[model samples]
Target: MAADRRVAEGLEHLKEAEKCMKTSFFKWKADYDGAASAYTKAGTCFKSAKSYDQARQAFLKAAECNVQNNVMFHAGKAYEQAGMMCKELNDLNRAAQLIEKAGHLYREHGVPDTAASTFDRVAKLLEPTNPQKAVDYYLIGSDITECEDRPRQAADFQKKAAKLLVRMGNYDRAVEVLKVEKKFQIEGENAPEVSRVTVELVLCHLARGDFVAADKAYKDAYGIPGFTESDHCRELAELLDAYDENDQDRLSSVAARPMFKFMDNDYAKLARGLQAPGGGEGGKKKKAALLDEGIEEGMEKGQLENQEVGGEDEDEFEGGLC
Candidate 1:
């Protein structure tokens, strides 16, 4: 429980800071820098008191003041702090939106990597409830990463986005994203990565019930030297053949063959649904659950892991306090 005295103290500090900021901005010859600094102090006090919602508001006000003062870099940095507070409060959607704003501001300030990272966070936050939005943000982030000359990191984000798209059953878009990755991967250098992407593409096609497309993807994947020899690859081939033959029993057997340890093999569930008594409603529910869980994993993992990259930058934020 929050201490009542601490909460009241925090609110008092916040109100006093707001009063000072207004006095500075409106009556003191528009001293925007002073107002921004006061707001940053208010945010610091709120954060120290564990009043995260108030801290977020204070930080956002600081950002607005910085923007008005033409200190765009500080504005972006202030928004980044506000986003962190929202994230801490479990208001992920609000955090993502603020982070996206920070990303654009950072990009405008010529901080490519920071901008890319902020966009990545936004994508991860949106992945579960709005995968399409996640994919869009990931694309933007990956392009920025590429521009920052971090091709491998860019490829990783693209692959992540593609996987989310596949989980969302947007196979066509997944294929497109993977194709972009393919263009970046050097032959014999990232060959395994390329092969993995191809495997994912084949699975996406199969999930979409495009047997011919799946077969084509499988064949294309095999054309890469040493690609079709893995036991996993062999199982994928058999699965494709079964799907092409319209043999539900064979498809079910092949899809359940334990080749996919990383992803849920929904093909087996789909086949079983066809063979079920009540028109596959149970299978449909399972498939939907699988999609939800997969996307949720991506979203939650990003928040858990990705936040560690630049945490040491807190000292810079400390310097902004009045």
Candidate 2:
């Protein structure tokens, strides 16, 4: 009871601070710094009062004030704080959005590393619910990392984006993103990165149900020096051979083989879905149907788990057809 009373008192103080912040904003023209200071005070009070939602809003208001004053660096920090509060509230989409705002501000302020890192976090947050958005954030991060002369980091982000693209059945886009991996390759040298990218491209093509393109990607990767040195690479070669020969039995055998354990789950799931009865026979609608069935199944499983754990249901966010 005492704790509740203390919280109520703190909330009253926060409300007073918020009123002062608003008065500073409207009554004093060009006093953005004063308003920002008031907003920060209000945010602190909101935090003390355990009003996280209000705290996030107050910090965002401060960020807006800083942005209006062209103090973008400070504004970016404020936005990051708001994003952290959103994370604490378990509002991942909102957090990702806030962080993305911070990332843009940081980039505009010439803070490449911070911008890249912020965008990476945004991508990670969006990955489970909105993979296309995740891919977009990852690509942005990759661009920033590449500009910072970090090819390996750039390739890593690009690869992650490609993986999501493949899962979303945007194989063409996946291939395009994976091509960025070649930027890390040295001329006239055997680079494992190059082979790795080619293998991913093969998977993308296969996921798109394009055996011809998959064959080309596979052969290209297989011809690379030291490609077969890796056991996994050899397995990929055998899989490609099966695909080339149009041998359904061999394809199924290889897909089921433990040697393919290194395959990404998204790739495996997509492959299984495509190979199912009447799968890959129709056009985009057919693909969407398959995806919907999988989504429904997943939702059912998630609901069951939630019931078992006595947790509130989480909202689902679906991305557009890739």
Model 1 TM-score?
A: 0.71
lDDT of 2 by residue, 188-261 (tens): 24377787677667767776778788777666666677776875577677776666555555556667666444
Count of clashes, each model: 0, 0
Q: Pick the candidate with the highest TM-score.
A: 1
lDDT of 1: 0.74
Clashing pairs in 1: none
Pairs in steric clash, model 2: none
Task: Give TM per candidate.
Answer: 0.71, 0.70
Off-target runs (Cα >4 Å) in candidate 2 are: 1-31, 34-38, 86-94, 185-190, 222-225, 270-322
Instruction: Provide the global lDDT of candidate 2 against the true structure.
Output: 0.74
